[model samples]
Target: MTNASDAAGDEKTKTANEKAMAGSETDTTSPASPTVRTEHEDDLDDAFKYLHDHSNAESTSIDLAALRRKIDWRIVPIMFVCYVLQFVDKVVINYAAVMGINKDLALTKNNFTNVGSAFFIAYLIAEVPTGESTSSHGANKVLTHILQDISSRNFHLESGWALTCLSGESVAQRPQEQPTITLFSPHYYTKSEQAPRFAIWYSGLGFGQIIGGLISFAFQHVTNKHFKSWQAMFVFVGIATSLVGMATFFILPDSPMKAKWLSEPEKAALLKYVSINQTGIQNKNFKMRQALEVLADPQLWLLTICTICISVSSGVITTYSATLIQSFGFTPKRTALLNMPSGLVSIAAALIVGFGVRKSESRWAWLVLCCIPGMIGGGLMSFMPASNRAGLLAGIYLVNAITGTLTVIYQWTMANVSGHTKRSVAAALIAGSFSIGNIIGPQTFQARDAPRYYPANIAVMSTQAGGAVVAIVLFGYYVWANNQKDKRQAVEEGLSSSAGNEKILWENLTDKENPNFRYVY
Candidate 1:
């Protein structure tokens, strides 16, 4: 009986090795298309290397649903906390404006608006380098979290406008942190499963809004002589943010392959399932070709423009909503409370569109649907009389619906782009465009237009409409590109549009280079 059992185990090991070897050969030069190799052997994905070495491992039965749940529980909460703290740290300045930071710091004229703009300026400059750093350094997401922790520590040091300027610099590191957060879902989930997961984490922005408001409101009651309420709020949020950052460093896995809790077989199985994305698991090679392709990729440009347009409204909401409410004859404490409802609006919109995309698979449609309410809200804010405080306040809440479009945009970029270098560059471009819009958003609100910034409100309305139009154009472009690829494949290879093999999926090819890749709208 012992001899028989050993023989059976040996046979199983032999069969597993054979299967792994066969899988590894799929990406090699094929007889049908013999002109060139899809990728150099050195450029193969990290998952490819893992599978090659683990060839003799026995195949274990895995419940994909259970595995997914396990991954979600372990990683999603960490991501959620990181996002919440980042936003709260950044927007705490908005709350502080009402808490008398401007008066206490002796900021006059456009000094307040400049402070808001300064954050995005730093954010824009840091975007590309951060993306490059993540890609070149083995795509480790934890590095950014550590950087965030270091930046958060500075929040406790400065006083006066110096405190606010340091806040801008600290939060500017967020652009570095965000792409990694958004990039995490695509690694584990398929196109269909990604929307809701993205929403789950991105909703941290809304939670930050609510929690920031409560923090500001609570701190306003502080009666200390040496430290003001705003100063205390900074210290409290800074300490909390640093703690969460430390937790992220220890808890979050850089990628599925790096996840310590998953067994070797489980990791292989997960990688195989997500291979359908036609976007390989992490590749560290920085291809100059892929980097150059970004400059000319129409999809990248369109996505960047759309992000910029929608983010204009986000800037308005993040920096000035409290100031707007206070301008409506409310006290500082009441203004903070009033801002809390907008958080609910943001959360509701994110959940609605997230589940909507998952159910209907119409990302573009959901994006346009979100923009409509935002445009309506912009109109209301622009036209409603200030005496009608309730009406204008309703407008402010409705504007938050546009925030959902950002969640869609984030998922869309990850799902549609392929190749590690191209994806990284694209993420940076989209993020930088966001900073550009934010810069523009605050500049539109000159002190000259005190109570009612008509120009800024109109800019919000116009940009929302523009974003919807561009989203439609982007959808049309994807459809046309897919058709063109199909025609070329039929003529050159005598293959149908769906004629893709596992080999093509593992190759580190860009969406343009990979004939198998189909863009997800």
Candidate 2:
């Protein structure tokens, strides 16, 4: 009788609080709750229901700013290290070239070209399978576990094996989708908010480049008889990367659904917050039909083609940057130091253009921005005499700025693409195109064009210009397509007006299936 009497009194008081907070969407229905769970929150996965179900006095008082800080501290270090290792591993060869890979490996005229080309070939072949695997398995799990396997193998192979696509296992893991190259976007960030957040880790590529150059320089100075400087660089980077990979797999957040750094309420809050993306947190079950739809999607093809076109210049820089510096009459060690600046150039461009366009939500404008430098650089390198070292070197650095656009392309892919299966294929296709361009990029610098390498320089200039034009055309197409959709939607809803209704943000709908979907340009 005493317990019943107290419960009745409490219920009456709770009703009053509910009535007081009725006007707020944030007010939860529970009497003690200050915030209400919207219909949207109810639709989330069971694992994340706690976000909207908080009933305590403290639930309403969560420090979102504090939560964001906590998330940043935990997430950034993992991604930064991952990106740094990838950049270091891939371009370590550029340093290796200067460290006498040609003489040490007895790489004759076509051998260097063949070696460079071969690595990408392996990379291209692996991308689609990795993509399919990732889309089927989920990026967070697959990307890490696979890297663990490869990094271990790489440690053994680095002693003698030429570095071949050491960075091929790329997928941005939609839960934390990468700007590119396994870019993790943190869907919690809106398109506008993504750049500043992502630029922090994406800038690691620059640091990695700098560190790799120093390591190469240091190794070259070692007086070893059995192992060349290049071999030492490989072994050291490989062991460190392998260990990092193992540690990261254990420590990094697998997904927001399972992030240990965040409390249950924080996880729920983060999930609810990012529901604007229209893409869900993560979906492990792969849909075959979405994969088929990717083949028919025009946007995927355009994105892939763009990657191919831009990567042509990437191939040139990746394979020949050291040789070009050597051509400038710099000693091998000096070449390593000179090459360090390119990483800095790449870093500046990534942060500037990545965050710059993200602020305006203007992807097309940024693509053009990135390409302009490449075009100018290519022209200077093509027309200038090889003996004009400063001018040619300036061109090398300028061309690296294009690396920023590659991240933009990745961001664009994550923004416009829908459907897990199709996105997986899209990642593979875009990455594959990167390989194709790289393949073409190195071939342009044929033995025939060796000393002057005018043809390769021309290729870089023309392709970048071509890529920019294509980007503009694609931009126009996106506008045209959006207008058509708006018109069609207004008609279907029996309204003369084109105002949009609420979209079903989750449900894993394909872009074609969802009429309410809008593309980010």
In every candidate, how many clashes are there?
0, 13
Model 2 segments beyond 4 Å from truth?
Answer: 1-61, 136-138, 153-183, 494-503
Q: Candidate 1, residue 78: CA error in Å?
A: 1.0
Residues 211-326, candidate 1, lDDT per residue (tens digit)?
A: 99999999999978678888889878877877776666667777888889998877877776677677777887888899899999999899999999999998898899999999
- Candidate 1 stretches greater than 4 Å from native: 1-39, 138-161, 494-500
lDDT values, one for every candidate: 0.79, 0.67
lDDT string for model 2 (1-521, tens) is 11222222324223422332222224333544423235544443322333334433243355555665676667767777877886677677778788877777676777678667776776776665656566445555654664454444333323223333333332122112232234345444444445555565777778887898899889988878776677778778777777776777676654676677667666655554455555555555567898899888888888888888999999999888888888778999999999999999989988887667644667889988899999999998889876789998999899998878887787787777776666667767777788789888888877877776899999999999888988888798789878877788877863222112112444567777767666778
Can you give the lDDT of residue 300 in candidate 2? 80
